[model samples]
Target chain A: MQINSSMKKSFLFKSLVDYLYILNVGGFLLLLTTISFGFVEINVIKGGDEHWSLLAISISCISVLTCIVFLRGVYYLRKMARHLLTHKYFSKQIIKCLKISGTHFLLAGVMFVVIMILGWIGKLREGLFEFVYDINLMVPLFLMIIGLFFMIQSEALLVAKNFKEENELTV
Target chain B: MPIIINLDVMLAKRKIRSKELSERIGITTSNLSILKSGKAKAIRFSTLEAICKALECQPKDILEYRDS
Candidate 1:
């Protein structure tokens, strides 16, 4: 009974899931505001230039899409965390959630990289490309690594599930 | 799958209910049911001993081999 309670309230996963939820909402709102600002700049202000408006709109559109994909990943992570909280360490739902989360994260990472590349190319064409390195490059790279890790963890958990079943059946 | 547990038979012979036997052997009713239903992968010697003592029977009386 004590174990069940502790498992049900595992603070680490609970906190992590909560943090992810905040991040998801914040990211979505930020992207929406950016898109709104882009439109306002283009339509409301006659003095505003076209290039920044267009760039902002395009970037925000792409970001909104990526955020949606990333939201899916976060959703699965929350589901997975719920299962973990219930002490269901080796179940089909967890494996499926992990797999889905991994795919979404991988897709989001790839899309983000593409967006950055396109932006970089646009700047280069405009002769505005900077030579300095951008730390923002690490975000997508880390996301991809996390996706791969989740995939690998799911596979590892698959094998562990078999062992767990075998152990459970042992009288 | 080939190894069968005949704990139900022994329980019947001993006129003991599953809940009673589980209590006597200090195991959960679900685990006892698993043993009786032949779903258990393996039985520990200690559990076998406890069951044997509770039912006043040998391990052979509680376990059997089947071709299927």
Candidate 2:
């Protein structure tokens, strides 16, 4: 069959999703390899104090969990993109994927906040108050907002699906 | 739903097949089936008028309301 304009657009969007998936996986692998090879040192506290070491380990664990959550979210997003590519716009799979991905992002955001708080407390104990001025803290805030946006988008899509069903069923 | 479609009964009473009625009313058989099976959320006035004309019956003949 001949392709239409909408199909072309969907194909373009699918390609974009493919790029995002590749970039996410590649960046994650690169980060892991760099960290494991001692190329990028993640030293949170110097002198190796017991309490600071515990805080560092906890922060590292939370960061890894956040990364895993982000990866899972991207996986579900890939699934949703595949469904859209096949023109299954209102499929239940899309809604389910959206919900799963949204939850993952929200969880990642919460984990990030926990990591920041732990790091903040650690720094306060070390008498370093300059950590609060770090501009990198906006990342978790943006993640939370994006997560809520995805959740709301899924709800809006659900409403649109209901309307489509009602229109189709009307005889 | 409390509002039920009785298109099947009307079709049977008129001795018309679902396919024939759908063709006559310019609608698909699946849509006609939805109406017959009471799965339709709502019916348009134009479609109801077309169905009424095709079956030669009043609107009440094909639609009935009942308390849940």
Candidate 3:
């Protein structure tokens, strides 16, 4: 079908699942780097002191955990898609995860923007530099945030339905 | 809020089995049962349309309106 990529038949959930999985693993790596090397390097390269380093570490922890949760949700989504006629506990989990991850991505985006602004403003206060980021980098982040919102909405709709369909099928 | 699905009535009138209707409608027998039992929360326009077409009736033939 022309809409396969946009439909459940094409297993679109795999994309979100992949994103969450990557985020989890990448976050863990970042956490490791921050602890093992970035801690030392940031002070030299970015002029970010130990406090910034610690905050980076904390955010990494939060993101890694969130990504893991979202990835677990991915498993449930795939399961539900494959078993359209079964109403089980895992189905409920999929819906719950959709709601959580949807909100999670949006929140993460907001937090990122806030932290970037604060980081820039903090630099401005020091009179050392101004915030000068290429527009390209910021565009993707905003687009990603918007995509997460729509994904969450659409996935949640799929989850809410079919209980009745499953019920009919089972009976 | 009181939209009654008249699938049962139509099936009774036609002397058809749920399994037969499901087969015709391309759904599992259990799901057809669920629809007949009024346990379904929502039905797709396509599925409902198929049922209506197969039964040779309008949606109102299978779905009724009442003040709830």
- Say which candidate scores most in lDDT: 2
Which DockQ value does candidate 1 get?
Answer: 0.64
**Candidate 1 has which clashing residue pairs, if any?**
none
**lDDT of candidate 1 over A38-74, digit per residue (tens):** 7533341132454555655676678778888999899
Sorted on TM-score, best first, the list reads 2, 1, 3
lDDT of each: 0.83, 0.84, 0.61
TM-score of chain B of each: 0.94, 0.95, 0.88
Off by over 4 Å in 3: A1-27, A30-34, A37-40, A44-94, A135-140, A155-171, B1-68
- Docking tier of model 1: it is medium
**lDDT score for residue A20 of model 2:** 81
Instruction: Judging by DockQ, tell me the better candidate of 1 and 3.
Output: 1
The alpha-carbon RMSD values of the candidates against the true structure, listed in the order shown, are 5.4, 3.1, 8.3
Best by TM-score: 2
- After superposition, which runs of candidate 2 have C-alpha atoms over 4 Å from their true positions? A1-13, A26-42, A47-52, A132-135
Provide the global lDDT of candidate 2 against the true structure.
0.84
| lDDT of candidate 3 over A56-147, digit per residue (tens) | 55545554554554445444444444443232423555455555555545555555555555555555656768647688457438735754
iRMSD values, candidates in order: 0.7, 0.7, 4.5
